[model samples]
Target: MEVDYVVVGGGSAGCVLAARLSEDPAVQVALLEAGPPDASVLIHCPAGLALLAKNGQANWGFETVPQPGLGGRRGYQPRGKVLGGSSSVNAMIYARGHHADYDAWAAEGNAGWSWDEVLPYFRKAEHNERGADAWHGSGGPLNVMDLRSPHRFGPIFVQAGMQAGFRENRDFNGAEQEGVGLFQVTHRNGERCSAAKAYLTPHLARPNLHVVTGAHATRILFDGRRAVGVAYRHERTIQSVKARREVLLSAGALLSPQLLMLSGVGPAAHLQEHGIPVLHDLPGVGRNLHDHIDVVQVVEAPHLTDLFGLSPRGIANALKGIVEWRRHRSGLLTTNFAEAGGFIKSDPAEPLPDLQLHFVIGKLMDHGRQTVWGHGYSCHVCLLRPRSRGSLLLASKDPLAPPRIDPNFLADADDLRRLVRGFRVMRDILAQPVLAAFRGREQAASAAAVSDEQVERFIRGHADTIYHPVGSCRMGSGPLDVVDAQLRVHGMQGLRVVDASIMPSIVGGNTNAPVIMIGEKAADLVKAAREPVHATREAVAA
Candidate 1:
């Protein structure tokens, strides 16, 4: 099949790209997704996040090679394979990240990507519940809603935060993002609103758009130095689709860079080693991997108000919740797994919070529902900025095989220091009198005495990723950069990566909103590039 644009992966970014690019009505866009349709009930229910992982129905369930830094234990990295990808199964918290994070991208030779430039796209894609303003939008495709029925502990958590010296900000995505408060979730009505639901669902009927599920993009088909199309596998057969204008890759951090490498667009020697002849000699295609490392500090709770204690009776009561949500558009089912969270900077001098905290009223552990017999109060702390770097490499030439993900977490001394500070921050928050009422006892046993060295040891033993992976295909203008500011591969034409992979650095918070924004902005850039000069002049004049 041939089209104007062939978008690989229908995740948060790809969904937005396909939706926006097809808006012209004259252009043809095809979105290819390897996973099945995203109709799973678990995806729509806020409390169902635990069931999605390891179920094989919604997730890729990729496991990483045992990291030496993480004590030779292989980590489980779950990426959603269904229509909306990770956004479908995520906690649904909406965060745009700190301003400095985007400004740093522009400073690192990626012009036109400063926070000032990116914020408009963020607004343009959001339909925030808090109403429209300079910082938010009310008519955008993506839905951002204030929590309708917060957990009983939500307000107490905020008050406790204030007692601990953290200011309270109603909107984290507003003018300034510092302080403790209720999180805004990606929901429309009372259902989980993923990018697919917000962007692609509304545009699927367009004759200009074609969405193909269960089709996995295998490799980029190159015509000399230009990317012409893609080869994919579906129903045990390999098929090829050509893009007349461009082959945009939104395959995400793990797969996009890995696919580029598989297609010989990565490290020269590594591609040759796998018998894949080199197409582009970009040494940084799969380098500079980064992700937030988090340690879940669990404490036993006095009351059964936590997620675990909800009875069979509670689930039965939830039927009333379902009816209430279906009728009034408000209930317990609408809850985003995280009811409360905030940001804090370890160094007081920093402009914005460097630590991201997620407060959960559930006993979510072992990647959510691997085991759930215990009742607890859990607050996870993830260092927003880590000095650690990792890499993504082709495990084999086969596209079916998952890539080797070495986050190399805690390899840097600074990352260890930051995580230690994050743990302390969580401790301080729990120490507040309001939270002290619920605090029971420490569940994760202390490794040693409470010295700095002992804390470092505990961190090394306990630290794991917060699931925010980026920088595998770092965007910039230097020899080490793989893609440019417009997300075009550094030396390749008609090929662009518009996903988490192209992030020069990971954002401060969850990646769903930022990844969706990348898709929106990418469509604009692609549209602008293909527009005729006279037409552009006419539009500007109009």
Candidate 2:
């Protein structure tokens, strides 16, 4: 097959790229996805997110190597393989991060990426249910709305934070991101409004836009130094498709680099070691891996209603909740689990909030791998800007084989110290008057420890990822840069990466909203270069 563009991986970014590029009636776009279509009932239901952690229908359940910093525990990395990617399976929080984060990108020679410049894209992609404001936009594809009916315990969390001396922030995406509040989600009414549901689904009828799911991209087909096509495996059959204009890799932070290495476009020494021929030899293709290294303080709250647990009464309530949700779309099932949270500084002297919190009305441990029974609440306190960095390397030359993931979490002592502080602060918040009504037994590994030394030990023994990973294929203008200011891969032509993988650093909040913004910005760049590329398509097309 041939098209003006071929976007590999029909995840969040690929969905946007295929939809936006095909807006022009003259352009033909093809989106290839390794996973099945996002048609599961579990994906659309906000409460179904928990079930997905165990169901592998639309998730890439990848695990990290035993980390020395994490006490030799393999951290779980669950990335979405379906249409909207992680956005489809995440908590549905709509956080753009602090203004300083984007400015940091601009400060690093990445022009047009400062907070002021990127705010328009954020507005452009949002259709806030609260209506348009100075910081928000309406009539856009992505729906950002207030939860229809939050759980009973959600407000208690906010009230508790306020009672603990934290200010109430009506909007985290608004003026300041330094206070506690109930998070606004990327939902419409009660269902999940993923990128596919907002952008791609509405345009699937367009003849120019075609999507092929269950197709695993094996390698990029390059003609000399320019990317021209992609070779993929579909239903045990190898297929090749040509891209007339450009090839965008939107597989995500983990797989994007792995695909590049498979295509012979990554580190020279690493690729050569695996007996793969070299293409572009970009050394930074798989470097700079980072994420929100989070530690949770779990507390039993048997008094809270509509909370998830495994008691006989809790089981009955859950069954009743299914009926309530299906009948009116209003119940505990409508919640995003992380219904309330906030961003704050562990230290007052810091520039921005180095710590982020998500108040979950359930016992979430080991990335949902260990399900403890009984009603409870969890506060996720994550180090927003962790000092430690990790890398992604290929396990073998097989595209089907998973990559060797080494998050190297908590490799820095400062990260451990900050987390210790965050735990202390979160514990104070949970013990406030409002939450005191429901607070119960503590569940953290450091529950009995109060000293700094004990806290650090608990962090190393228990802290894990909040499912936000980025920077493997970073955007910049340096030796370590993979993509440039426009997200065009450095030292390469007719190729670009439009995903969370290009973040020079992880954003200060959840990654889904920022990744959608990256897609919106990348769409503009792709269209801006359309004329020149279109004129030269014949030469590049096979």
Q: How does residue 325 of candidate 2 score in lDDT?
A: 82
Q: What lDDT would each prediction earn against the true structure? A: 0.83, 0.88
- Per-residue lDDT of candidate 1, residues 1-542 (tens digit): 77888999999999999999999898989999999888877887765675675465588877777877677777778888989988998889999998888999999878888999998899999999889998998899999998878778777878888999999988898888889999999988777899999998888899999899999989888767777778899999988777778889998999999889988898899999899989888999889998888877776763554354355655565677678776876777777757898988877887768898888776556666455544566788888988889899998998998889888888888888878877887888877999887656666554242777777677677677777889898899878789998889988888899999899988888998999989989999999899321111111111
TM-score of each model, paired residue for residue = 0.94, 0.97
Cand. 1 Cα-lDDT: 0.83
Tens-digit per-residue lDDT, 208-227, candidate 2: 99899989999888777778
Residue 229 of model 1 has an lDDT of: 75
Residue pairs in steric clash, candidate 2? none
Off by over 4 Å in 2: 531-542
Q: Looking at candidate 2, what is the lDDT of residue 231?
A: 88
Residue pairs that clash (backbone atoms under 3 angstroms), model 1:
none
